[model samples]
Target: MGSSLSTPGASNANDRPAVAATLPPAGCPMHRKLEDATANVSPPPSAETNIDPRNNIPSLSQNPAYGQTIALPLERMRSSIPRTLSDLSTASEHESASTCPMARGGPSRTTEETKDTWVYPSPQQFYNALVRKGWETPVQAIPVMVDIHNWMNEAVWQEVLRWERRYFNPKQSNLALEPEEIPEVSLARFQGRPQDLSPKARFHMLLGRIFPNVYSELPPFDRHDWMVRRDGWGAEEQDKLHRYVIDYYSGADDEDGNPVFHFDVRPAIDDLDSLTARLQEWARIKRETWLGEEQSSITKDAKINN
Candidate 1:
């Protein structure tokens, strides 16, 4: 009996042009269809496509709403680094040193080094020095006394004047009287004082107290007063007094056209006199020394005229 050909390996038994083996039924149709679909579809792109999570984030670089990020490395570095006080100080110092000529190289010399050394003389010392130099004068002396008087109380001066009138007035003679009745006696006695001071003397005395000057060589009696009181000496005497006072304070030329001393009582008495004398002598010497200069000046003028 011929084996049933429709069983296992059935295609081998059908010898009339034996059929080729085929793929399993389950794979044939579905696999070919899948392959055909895949052929029709495009292949995945080959170029790199970087997908960054940061790109998804809202970035200052791309968004117009956000400020643009600084691109300069220096700007980024500046933002990242914290500045210290020392850095600022160094920068300031550099700028300052550069701007200022003195500060450029190093510190400037101290006041002591650059400035001349000066030793100020004491008040007493200065006065002594002036006296040694010879600058004191009569007018200078008087102002000192006046200054002293001014400093004294007004009541004191009034009392002094009262006593002076009482003791020096010559009209009244009675010294013995009750306190209330003694006005005449007091006036007479006050007027009768031994030291009969003239107005000039009083004025000079006032000045002397105000501006004390040891080097001043004032006459024992007030020459100024005597001159003023003289019967015949009116305007001329007054002029002379005025001139003398002015010369004593402001200085002037002597008879020979030589400059005299300038007497300032600001200094102590001793120093003032010396300074005055020195100034006077200096003026005189200068005049004598410069005599030729004046003559030469005249000669030059004459030549020019000729």
Candidate 2:
């Protein structure tokens, strides 16, 4: 059925020319008057004006340092100069909300989403960089080397004394031999804080307090007793070897290009690898024999000066 409505003019004579010439085609809903269709359409640019999007993009070549802004974290990491005290202080205030960094905070950004790249320390180059930057010796700051030596000596004597007392104590029997009690005494100071101790000292003390007699058989600590092999052939062996180095051979180095401290204190034997294996086996056994361990505030030679 066609529309019964007609234009509001004298067109009822049916002699009016077909409106298709001036109106939208029949059944074409989308067709609009040309004037209305073009009201919002922008006028075409002149021949002199270029409107291509590719041409309109701002030119980056205008910037003198385009694409050269380096990341502060990456910059600091790539350069091994030990961060300064001021840097640490600034870092402490950087983002207190974070507890993400494994090592004491160097710097941090409050985000779990980041592009992280690990910087494997190149010992010689790193130290050299530190020297160039005038980094203070760790002894002045952390006393890692000195305290490690001191802790080892103190540990040996404490264990020896404990064993002596235990051996002669009236407490005797098969059950007593494997008694469920471990002696844990700090030989550092009477009231000295263990947390205030150096890195190496702290490490030893924690392990000592945790496992007293387990490390008693740990042969006398000597700096030169064991040599850490850098690596072995094959990726699997190399990964194992790298992990061993990271575990035992700390990053601290002497000017002679040698490790300052050695935790893998394997005694000199025909085969060091075999000796280390034996020590691990002995440690595992001692660990199994251990019972409840505790920390006591007992010092070796602390005297109150009043």
Model 1 lDDT at residue 169: 25
List pairs with backbone clashes in candidate 2: none
Q: What is candidate 1's lDDT per residue for 1-306, written digit by digit as tens?
A: 011110111111110011111111110011122323232232332345221121111101111111212221111000111111111122221121110001111223333212111111222222222222232312223222222212211212222222223332233323333444432210000011113443333444465566555222231211110000111223432222101110011122334443222211111113443245334433533453456323111111110000
TM-score of 2: 0.17
Query: Which one is best on TM-score?
Result: 2
lDDT values of the candidates?
0.20, 0.23
Give Cα distance to truth, residue 269, candidate 2, Å: 3.3
Residue 296, candidate 1: Cα error in Å is: 67
RMSD of each: 59.1, 36.4
Total backbone clashes of candidate 2, pairs 3 or more residues apart or in separate chains: 0
